[model samples]
Target: MTAAAVETKIPASAEWMRPGRVAVLLFAVLSLVAFLLPDGVLPAWTRQLPAEFRIGLDTWISAALKWLVEDATFGLFTFKDLTRGFAQLLNVPLDIATSILSTGLLDGRGSSAIQLAPPLPWIAVVGVVAALGYRFGGSKLALLAGGAFLYLAVFGQWASAMLTLSSIVVAAPLGIAVGLATGVAGYRVPLLRRIITPILDLMQTVPTFAYLIPILFLFGFGPVAAMIATMIYAAPPMVRVTMAALEGVPREIVEYGTMAGTTPRQMITKVMLPAARPQLLVGVNQVIMLSLNMVIIASMIGAGGLGFDVLTSLRRLDIGRGLEAGLAIVVLAIALDRLSQAYAAGARKRDAEGGLKPFLFGLAAFVAVTYLLALFVPPIATYPEALQISTAPFWTDAVKWINVNFFNVFDAVKTFILLNLLLPVKRFMMAQPWPLVAAMVGYAGWRLGGARLAALVVGLALFPVVTGQWDYTMMTVYLCGISVVVAALIGIPIGIYGGLSPRAWRVIEPAIDTLQTLPSFVYLIPAVMLFRVGDFTAMLAIVLYAVAPSVRYAAHGIRNVPTMLMEAGTSMGCTQKQSLRHIQVPVALPTILLGINQTVMLALSMLVITALVGTRDLGQQVYMALTKADTGKGLVAGLCVAAIAIIADRLIGAAAQKLAAQRSGAVDAT
Candidate 1:
């Protein structure tokens, strides 16, 4: 083909080459060197370092950190004091759950006491859900809703699932109500947005463990505390997301509403919110996912049902039980996710279908099936070991095999990483003088964000050092760095290839969604089985969990690059690689940066769960605080993590904004 024809086919090529045998050779060399290198390479390397390095350089940093943690640092906040305060606060929820468990309707006394909440008659719920689905989309969605409810019934988990569902039924709407109020307030008032934004960021980024202690202490256990915790923990995302979506609704629509004699509330309800439905739905999805994610964690605080089952199974290392519970959770998640998604898609279908006739039929079918079974079959209780799916032999054999074969290999690798890499890197981060660290962070902020971002980042970075979590915070930073690096290594390239191919995106999207929805805890078992405990397994878990965002963002960024821009590159006689490198990448850089930012945030969020695998970081502190019921300690540690998240978010997001502005400015100048 002619050069022009070739250019039109794609774009200019940026020279690229695949390595031939280099990777294998490099690996061999590294392996050889690893054997040759003395294990003491780390100790000697650190031994020669100056004593004045990080220690004497950070006097003010140490003092500030010490002051921030003084109450906990000196053991001044006694466990008894914290425990007593928690007891006093648990009176209400404790009373309610106790009444349900101890004596009442469904208190397990008389035949009538064994039944609870009327089961919504099953028909009503299915009808509502199917109606919602039909209203949102139509036949496909109606089938999905009908099927999901049927699965619950046939699987013999209908009652327990419904009990869990009841909390969500209460919690989600409550979240939306709070979110709508907060979102409206945040949008209308600059000061409220300013205050709520940081809190929202903290809530979104901090591990769930941080919230549990406070909720447990304040409300005690059971569905109430669980509900309260779920609301508090999950509501911020909804509120923030809703506020952003609503605020972004077309000004013209609001003006039109005003011109049409609408009041402010009418404009918001009838115009802005409707126009922002896609984003609001995303908020709803986030709320559902977050609430469900916390369900298992909430069980630890006294919330019952599947979460409790999952917790019990995990504690006993009963993989079969855990898998069943996890599967139930996943099934519930899929049901809710598909049902909601269909509802969103069904909106268009609603215009065609006209009414609820189709939904009603499906609902009637579900009710007939569920009620007939519920009336006849005695309530299915937890099965005996013989009946349950037991992976004990398999998991035990697998763990034993790994312990025998890979233990030495993993131990050696872990030692090298901890001693040679992670420790020194952590020490260096912690060692930086506060002023120097602030200056560097401020510069990064200014370079990427501007003066406002720079100021915000510097302040956030300085806070944890002041709070005496400097060391622990540094450790979190290190783990995040490791996870982000690993995730990017895996995600960015996968995203690029997927972005280049529509067929790939189609295949990959479902996989990505599954990975994203899979609870972070579910992966821990396999990770521990493979890598054993310590930082390696934890890091691997974080990386695996965090990779989804990076891949998703990268693919989205690349795919969303304007078609006109691609055509322009082709018109200019550029090759595909050249166009991607010189044009597409530059334009997509801002969005790609956003993906990186997400990856970091997600990695940081997973750190607390990683702590359960035995990492001596802030996550450990948060986890320990939860078990000990040390609210203040947990809060401080949580804040420290929040500080880290906010600082990184500001820096990266600011950088992306700056780059976007620069690109726009250059385009404008041209």
Candidate 2:
């Protein structure tokens, strides 16, 4: 060992006992001081603050907002009326779809004039997918593609799944078409993109429930309205992705296309779109997952099928039915995702002769069986009662057991959370006075990024406070904070362990995917049963939903760190722990932070669904507004949630950018 190495190595130490010691000490002191203070300490402290510190003067503000909306809409713009109007408009498409199934020239009538449409011979759908898959990838992918369709059919959900699939089938293409056009528009006319970008940002961050109210109003409850709403919600990402992919296409390739005397349309279709195919497929995958996520929610306004059944079960507290329906959704989502992924993955491996013979044979066989069954077996469309499956009994028994045995303990935990944890956090944020908190957040942004990012942070953070939702807004923040913290506690270590080996990555990836795609509501049932309807349940739900991003990005970022650097650390006699702590972690921090940003967004999005656990937060406001048909109220609440999302996004994103730049600079210097 060298003398320099001996000098450089310090005595055994803990990171927590150094600079963080002061913070820990201060926390302890503050907690002690809080404990020593009288029960009226908060009230006295609040009294010392300026009057403007107060939030949400509800009655006056409500009246003023009502008047503003009335005046803005020329006295015919009440939210309820608007929702009613939307519902009426949406009814047309629902009526058409329903009438087609219920009354058309098709099947044997079942009571109401409506008769079920003969299921599309499964062979056709499968053949198209197989061909599409083969076109996208190759033989293995085509088989995977065929299998996904076969699973849907065998599972007896072929009919309803197809209905959901049809809407998405329609919405996905429409989204792609719109996104591609918009991407081109944005790329060509920067001004148009500039105008569209913020709306896109707002659309992505805003609670879907907020949009649902207005959509239901304009279109009325039905599949078409649901389709419209799904498109609106899911389209932005594709547009952004397509634009990015096109912009990133090599300048040389494009010039080659131009030099080849290709027309603009031909160049884009043959050159740009095909070249940008990979990213666009990613956008499509996003669209599929997002659309499926909304399947249950979309049913609220008349989009029917499994999602409707899921929602119905939720309302009835039939856990078996909810689980069955929710699992069905999960299975369908997995199937579509796998098929899409296989297609995309296979795109680079195009086959010579296209394996046309085998594919055609498979298609022929599938089609023959599907139509034959449709003709001979009426039961193919609807499964028999004996085949119906459920998980509701387990949930109900669990719910009852918890309620009976743990009610007092749960009550105490809830009270402690509300009175001690949540209340104190809320009061502290409120006590700071809005300007100070805004300034602090802005300053942090400036330190991490610069003036532009700081300005963005301030604007987003202040929006909700100015809108008079600061109190409930903070409640949402508190819940998110708890979830994010808990999730990080679990996720970061797992991510670290997973990043160490390919085997771990294989095990972790599917878990992450499952967590990522499982509908937000699915978590609500177990959370309510175990935790039993309080802040804790909501927090638990958020944590489970939010953990995936952290685990995914962390593992990805760490594993991707240059092996040469690890070798250098090894050459330096650094232990594995030291190499990871001092080398890998610093390099991976930016990506990990990116994961945290995603986790926060996911947690915020969970606000609407988690309200089943009884929160007094902004989501509850949105929920109440929905039931009361108060569009203005819902919009305001939705905006508050968006404000929280935007602020977190900006601050964390800026910090990550700064960290990446710092790491880059350090690398250059090395």
Candidate 3:
């Protein structure tokens, strides 16, 4: 070798002493020594920070909120009065939606009021929905949407489902409007996006329960609070999607608009927005789904509907009732989710004069006739109760049957997982000195993304320790970690099967779609019925709620593998398993890491919901705060959860980037 080449290469022994590697190694060693040493051997601050050193962010937040509610003013009105007035104004849309979907319009009289119209006949609602589905996605989608509404009518859940729909109609549009406007603003001013992104992250990551505590105090107990929460919860995703969509618009399109002599305003409205319309629809879909999700969780705070029914049933341990309510939610979500997704997809291939338009109009005309007929026949307005069907008894019996016959199997599985995997992990995490965990995480961040990431991660990790919340934080980590591991084990294989086989993908596609659309709360029902209330049940809920992304991302990664690469592997005489292991797996590793990152995020978000199942973690802390109306406790605990998710997401994302860079480097070298 030449002298230059000899000088460039480092010895193996020296490689171990590279700065990045050495820093982490030193951290590990120092942490171990500090942890194992006598209690007083090291400074007292090594174990826990003094109370005086704590930031007291929670206390400061509470004080600020208090001042806002009591002392702050807008003109002649106090802040509370202004908010309540705005809330009352918000009621107009909600009242209109409620009147149209749930209750018939009523007219004049104290004792003898007449119905101007019966709430749009269930048949009408189903018909209109099916028409929309057909207009966008053809026959199969029509059947799906129509069938779902039909089930709502026949299963005796029309009123509850209608109430739920009412809130969604009001909140979804408002969320879309605000998100779109904000996104547009951000696009126009790059600095706005930089400012908004972190705030959006905090808003999206904070527990849904945390939102309620403040809304509860601000708006008092009513659907208005719920409506506000839904809008807030749903808007962040729309903003993100909108910003991305706008940025993704082809540069050529903008130049075309400019050549046409469009002004800035005209360019945005007629050119940019129009070009971005298809992608904007994707954001709309996300907004609607997230709105529905928040509305359901908001049910706990007086946004009464099917969610209320489900919540009540769970509280009563009425498995049969809960199942029906949960299924209704699932179908409702599926209908809305599928319609929006189809609408967004169909935008690209839109044909204004298509034959399907006629079919849609025909369906709409039939729906109008049903409303006309309902005037004369009240039974047509509402399905007859005697004829309505419910499979509650069957569901109850099924649960009982399972418990009697397979109790031992469930007990053994639960015991094995809890004792061997979950409990031990929790113990190990809690036993780690706070300094050691922080140092370890800092080292990881440094290795993955360097000094800035290391500083960020250390600051976030130490917050819980300083705040005296280490035990609960560890509890959350243990549960989420195990759930992610289990989900990966199950979902990754299924994903691989789907990826490698087009036939398998055909089946897996719809199944995962259904799973993804179902609300988080719905997962809790089956888990509760099977495991009862405990950390194990919480784990199940988190796993079930989080597993879909892993399956989806993994399959996408596998399917997107370059055809030429696969052919090369085959040409080289590689076996199917060998090709997957050596070629496809490495190529897909980054995307798979992204999937795991999503799984971790989803797991953390579910922590608050799992608290309802009796897990003692940061989630439980927020839940307790909600009950007592303690904003400080709730917000602080919520921040901790967000911090955990942000840290994990950033670390995993950085690692994925590192892997991709390494993969690219190797390819370039070859």
- Per residue, candidate 3 scores C-alpha lDDT tens digits across 1-670 of 3322222221221232366776767776875565466657766665567889877877887888888888999788999998888889998898789778987776754468677766888878988998888888999999999999999989988999999999999999999999999998898889999999999989988888987988987887878889999999999988987889888989999999999999988988899998899889989999988887775689988899988988888787787888788788888988999999998888767655567667767876897899899889878888889989998889888988998899899989999988988876776665567777887888788877889999999999998877867778888888989999999998888898899999999999889877776677878877888788899999998988889889988898898866656666676676788677766777777788899999998899899989999999999999999998889889999989988988998888987887777555534433
lDDT of 2 at 444: 65
- After superposition, the stretches of candidate 1 with alpha carbons farther than 4 Å from their true spots are 1-113, 116-160, 348-353, 357-373, 377-420, 571-573, 665-670
Backbone clashes in model 1: 15
Per residue, candidate 2 scores C-alpha lDDT tens digits across 1-670 of 3322421332222321354466556655654555455656555422233346534444454565555444435365665566556556644554454433323233433465444445445556667677666666567767877666666566555666666776676666766677778887787778998998888888988888887876655556677778878888788888899879989999999999999999987888899988888888888888877888888778877677778877777677677667666776777787678777766666656443367677678767776676568667655434454654445577678778878998898778878877877667655544444554566677667766679878988887776665567668767887888789889889988998888878988999899888887878888876666566777778888989999999988898898876656666677787878777777777788888899899999999998888877988889888888787677678788988888888888878876776777666545543
TM-score of each: 0.77, 0.82, 0.92
Weakest 10 consecutive residues of candidate 3 by summed lDDT:
4-13
lDDT of 1 by residue, 344-372 (tens): 65555565557567656876676667555
Q: Rank the models by lDDT, top first.
A: 3, 2, 1
Q: Over 4 Å off in model 3, which ranges?
A: 1-47, 106-117, 348-351, 354-368, 667-670
The top-ranked prediction according to lDDT is 3
* C-alpha lDDT of candidate 3 relative to the true structure: 0.84
After superposition, candidate 2 runs with Cα above 4 Å error = 1-111, 114-117, 121-159, 261-267, 351-369, 379-427
Full-model lDDT for every candidate? 0.69, 0.72, 0.84
